[model samples]
Target: MHPSFQERIDEVGELLQRTKAARSGFYSRIDRRAPAKPVRYQVVGGSFGMYQIKDLTTGKTRAFRNDYKAAHDLAMQFEAKANRQITVAL
Candidate 1:
């Protein structure tokens, strides 16, 4: 036999509570808030063999010794500051 309307409603309520959709607000805030800008770092190499780390948004560059590791480390530092849970592409 098919479930009654009340029984179906109760089942859906339990499912929503299990998924935490019963109190979700993330979707409602999307239209009211501006999208976030993604952080990006570019590693540029100089002619003199030195490495430069550039912040794409600000056009600011920091110089590092001719070692790629140093420039990569600088990029990682920027990533840490931007979002600790996410990593930046090299």
Candidate 2:
């Protein structure tokens, strides 16, 4: 016995759906194995109106003289980059 044209098409569609589901599960397992740590930033005050943006994850620091806003902005940027998501349009 042979499948009709519509039945063949349906079989292909089911195969494609199964393949997609398996791929999704594979990636999900990979994601669970190595979870991402949230980036932490700290703004420290120094003498002579100096502000520092400290990245706790990497133990790196950036200094700003009399500019708290710039220091805070840099810290915020680092946090944003660490937490950003990649989106793909199909």
Candidate 3:
């Protein structure tokens, strides 16, 4: 698993516990409010393939498309896009 996946797992765990979002939505296993908070992630060209961005700040990571260039571009854009923004293609 990628490092970012671990980070997001931690972050989401905390988020789920705090909000009890896991019990919400059509599927109790899914969090209804999961999409509420803004997360930073990227999908850019990587050494082997596309990569995801691990938020060095929160120690949280998210998996994005496996593309190095795409990941790098989104990482750069996350610096400017609003929190409401989720996906952006570069």
| TM-scores for every candidate against the unseen true structure | 0.45, 0.44, 0.34
Highest TM-score against the true fold, candidate = 1
Model 3 misplaced regions, further than 4 Å: 1-48, 82-90
**lDDT tens string, model 1, 1-90?**
456988999999999786655234554556544325445777888767788888887888855658889888888887677665666899
Q: Write the per-residue lDDT of candidate 2 for residues 1-90, one digit (tens) a residue.
A: 356988999999999999877867877878854324545888888767788787787777755546888888887887887687989999
Off by over 4 Å in 1: 1-39, 84-90
Q: In model 1, state the lDDT of residue 85.
A: 60
RMSD of each candidate relative to the true structure: 16.7, 16.4, 14.6
Higher-TM-score candidate of 2 and 3:
2
- For residue 76, model 3's alpha carbon misses the true position, in angstroms, by 0.8
- lDDT (10s digit) by residue, model 3, range 15-66: 8786654344434455344545454554433456647676655666554756
Q: What TM-score, to 2 decimals, does candidate 1 have? A: 0.45
Ten contiguous residues with the weakest lDDT in model 1: 26-35
**Which candidate, 1 or 3, has the higher TM-score?**
1
Candidate 2 Cα errors over 4 Å, as ranges: 1-39, 63-65, 86-90
